[model samples]
Target: MNTIVDFQQFNNATLEQVRTRFEEEFGVMTYFMNPAPRPCFNKICMSELHQSQTSLEKMQGEVIANGKVSQANYLVLASDIPGIFNLGGDLSVFGDLIRAKARDHLLAYAKLCVNNVWTFYNMQAPVTTISLVQGQAMGGGFEAALAAHIMVAEKSALMGLPEVLFNLFPGMGALSFLSRKIGMPAAEKMVRSGKIYTGEELYQLGVVDVLAEDGQGQYALNNWIKKNHRSLNSFQAINRAKQRVNPLTIEELYDITEIWVDAALRLDERNLKVMERLVRAQNSKVNSDVAHIQEKQSA
Candidate 1:
């Protein structure tokens, strides 16, 4: 469709102003791709990465926005809603783009967006980054948060790899980054099960760095940034040191993601049904266990 670059609001703004606005609005550092919820307005309305729902140039512009913020060494990414951070890539957009034979360009854009987030994650800035999560952060959305040095969430944020539900898998470097953070077993379980998790459960699994009190995830994020500004460089160094020993490289994982994407494109309705059953069965078991724990606590 139209590949127009909309820099109307940003045309005259200085880089530092953009950075400050990004932090103030997202409680992190970055630009939001989707605006307020308007169902069916656009199927794949993700915030962390630019969704090329229309044209490649528009998508590139989104990444440029993130790049501008990153250069300022302040928070570069943030979501509009406090709880549900991002829903991931838009399947309908994928379907449309593929029909138009735009897969190659789309893949390139996806790589650019993924790399942008990775750069943010690997930044040596003392300002650091954070994800204020209280709701669902699925697929790429979840990956974006995991890339951050710290993921602060309220007890209610549900994080997961739900791409399988859409006949795909986490291709946005999530399979590598998340697996390294939470270890293979937990990571595998998350991918295979596509299980959504409470923020407290994520903390227990070490996916969430800081847990919010009484479901105040945004408040926790602001507080963490205020107290830890000076300590960010040290924190990044320590975390990078640990990441260096990890098994998966971005290249290897990106290949795995491509395999999943190709498979998703080839997925038949029968296979999708089977995946749905697997995810549902896993969710049922987890919910039952959670109920048991709640009962025990009440008793």
Candidate 2:
């Protein structure tokens, strides 16, 4: 566990240069090769909203290329945050854009998000994508998790799309991915309910692929990978077949996003007030996480 994989020698200088390594407690490391035939772990540290999205897009490009050239069999998307996978869209930016009536800018952001999700959903490369959710994944965060070919979540983790609470919807592929996973009716119910479900609940609802015990997410991921390694080709083929049967097109997502932008623009003062409150909640969560890390370090 103490040893780090030296990626520079692999001639992937770009990845080596841009890859980030978080503190040990966060358990975040990106694009590190595992033992023979094991998938590479690509840690995604979701701290800032725009920065995280940009980073994820870049990671996706690298991963797609890496899989093609290096033949990396698996790619796991995980977080560096201890108790929060991602809080979702940048509410602060949303608030500003909405207030300023910047429809084009908002649409651009949504498109960027969809581009990343579309890439993951299609798995353009010959690699299987997995999402390891050890904590809360809300709104766009939940959509990101759903984009993966497989979702492995810890029992204590929570996932939900709370956009409806702020008088909006998760437009960046949430409806598309969730509907495909659990059917349209069920997906619509969950989105409108705005309720957060534990990993166990989602698993029972057939949304979560693997449910692991708390603090054992990494172990569970490794175990699942090992178990599926021999049948990887079959597993990947099944994923492809699933997509073919229920195709999720980029055009569909873009159309939904346009609706989302229009809805956002029409939000009344009360709705914006609620969104502002949610922004405060997100900031509070970030502060709490910082305090937790500080407490742990001081201990």
Candidate 3:
């Protein structure tokens, strides 16, 4: 289904209005949205379908708003759909732009959203941003999730950076976030393989914090909020210090994207076959090991 996302509407909202609107929308008073405010932190939820220019802009505004609201509480940044979080830069937008030879404009728009998330990640808000995943969070969807300090996934959630499948790479800071959180080896596996994860596996890999069963997710989040509320100053201090000590840089992300894009452009059916073979080989090895252990027990 083609969801019409409106960005312009979101971009036009004043900082204070955005804050109040979000609070009213989510029934959470402790949080608000103020992207421009430096020390803003509070409880909010940033989510959208990201279908059009307006949609993307709205999500961006929501993130900025969350930054403004970051005070003593955390925000939940999620998409409307439980199954498909974000499919990435609107292919429709790119396909039309590319056909019309508006490549530069397309690139500029894409970069704008990417950079906005980068700013969100580095915001000085005492906000503990969490990504709530329900369905398929692929490409930029996965990238946006990575921007948060934590990820909460429903058991049915599927996550991956599948930009390679489209002959592109993660233009956002997804590669950087993945590398920092999961290390280069695992991150490379995720990108090069295009293998997605269930919430269970993601939790095991430390990508998601809570493996919630539908409605229970909010309670888990509330529990997290309660635990963090008393130590807001300390929580912010530790996070800020950690960022200062080992922050993900834009240059590093650019370099990673370039490498992945190069690989993506070269990817074809032949490479997919090779990747499948590698996966089969790895799975076979694992099964063999499991069978051997079973045999020893039986003996």
Best by lDDT: 2
**Candidate 1 vs candidate 2, lDDT winner:** 2
Residue 86 of model 1 has an lDDT of 63
Model 1: residues with Cα > 4 Å off, grouped in runs: 1-33, 36-76, 97-102, 124-127, 247-249, 269-299
Q: Where does candidate 3 stray beyond 4 Å?
A: 1-72, 254-299
Least accurate stretch of 10 residues (summed lDDT) in model 3?
36-45
What would the C-alpha RMSD of candidate 2 be, to one decimal place? 7.2
- Encode model 3's per-residue lDDT on 229-299: one tens digit a residue: 67766876887787787777766665555554444435565544544453354345446656787899999
Residue 257 lDDT, candidate 2, scale 0-100:
92
Residue by residue across 58-113, what tens digits does model 1's lDDT show? 23223234334222234434554433466555544555455565657556646654
What lDDT score belongs to each candidate, Candidate 1 first? Answer: 0.56, 0.70, 0.54
* Pairs of residues clashing in candidate 2: none
> 120-186, model 2: which lDDT tens digit per residue?
6775656677788888888887888898898999998999988888788888888898889899999
Worst 10 residues of 1 by lDDT: 52-61
How much is 188 displaced in model 3, in angstroms? Answer: 0.7
TM-score winner between 1 and 3, please give it: 1
